[model samples]
Target: MTFQYIAQRFERSGSGSDSFKALFKSAFDLMKEDTANASLYFLIAVAAKSYVRTYEDQAVTEEVAERAKTILCGYNTRVLEALAAEPAARYAIGSGIAYDYEWQVADF
Candidate 1:
């Protein structure tokens, strides 16, 4: 499925923080289990944390959050950097809010 579909699904049906976390978990699982949208999944993983950090009372545990960070820091720095460099590509990989939030993360 496209990132747009995922975003729409989340907004329409993912009513709470737990639902957001579940979406993140699904993205993480897809990242491990498939290769088609690794960049997209990475974007979702990071955006999930950002969303929780701001609006949600339910935060992703530090361990899971750190693991996601470590994966990016250790293994996918180039992936994130490359995606960040292109505005359109980043948008294509994420929905509006996700694109904005996750693109900010790619700079670091």
Candidate 2:
């Protein structure tokens, strides 16, 4: 499925960036709710590609990748759900990656 492919490519299993954490913060701020780290879903999406820069001309600096939070939410809502539903996916909900996730999006 599209979700599986996208997840594999973007999960960055062994790789964690300060940018990823920034995306988490931004998405949380944009969504304005903390029930779940759903924000991380959007964060991963925007961080995947430089082409998504600023995502609306908002600003795409590594320091402010949160701006793309607005753009990623619409597309990655389901991806978040899939990861969250996984027992091993606690990190997707803001727990931090405890294991590698397969992100096979190379076809993109």
Candidate 3:
């Protein structure tokens, strides 16, 4: 699923009550589907991190943040493994120069 679709799902999943938990559950459920696209996990990680950051001004218990971090780390490791198994390729821009591209896992 696309990031926008994930965002819509998050909105419908009642994120306000327990934002981090809801995000974690959503990501966990999606991961259980066993989608082969690594980008979906990356998007989920981005969405979860972005949602969690929105609570910076509020009182986010350390335990909640740590729990979410742990789950996210596991998902990231899977993404890295998926990327490693894919072949390296090149992409051509509008200028016609083909540049080599590789997927790099970003730490949250």
Candidate 4:
């Protein structure tokens, strides 16, 4: 799956980037080496890092930043595995090119 896909999913989940970054940090030391698990974690790591940039929070440690990238790359093969699983269910139509779809369907 693309960054957009995971971003869309979590973004639509109404999760904060701070939450995502913290979750990834907490989960970082414990992710399984198994391909699927690793891949999802990698997605989470990358998403956490990328999403953090959009926030107004104070800068994170270079250590944290490096750790995020390292964890994601350690599972590179797994990340690629996830990337092969599916595409974005929907595409965005405007700026940022970020995934912004609503996860729930509602009668309007």
The candidate maximizing TM-score is: 1
Which digits, one per residue and each the tens of the lDDT, describe model 2 over residues 8-70?
443433223343444444444544444344445444534444333324344345434433332
Candidate lDDT values, in order: 0.52, 0.40, 0.45, 0.41
Stretches > 4 Å off in candidate 2 = 1-31, 54-78, 83-87, 90-108
Ranking by lDDT: 1, 3, 4, 2
TM of each candidate vs. truth: 0.45, 0.26, 0.37, 0.32
lDDT of candidate 3?
A: 0.45
Lowest summed lDDT window (length 10), candidate 2: 99-108
Model 2: lDDT to the true structure: 0.40
Best by lDDT: 1
Model 1 agreement with the true structure over 1-108: per-residue lDDT tens digits? 544445455555534456557667766776776565576676666666555655466445656545444433322333344345575665554454344454545422
lDDT of 3 by residue, 1-89 (tens): 44334444544543242655565556656665645543445454554655456664577566655654554444444344444453332
Where does candidate 2 clash, by residue pair? Answer: 7-103, 8-102, 8-103, 8-104, 9-103, 9-104
Ranking by TM-score: 1, 3, 4, 2
Question: Distance (Å) between predicted and true CA of 59, model 4?
Answer: 13
The alpha-carbon deviation from the true structure for residue 38 of candidate 2, after best TM-score superposition, in angstroms, is: 4.6
Off by over 4 Å in 1: 1-9, 58-99, 102-108
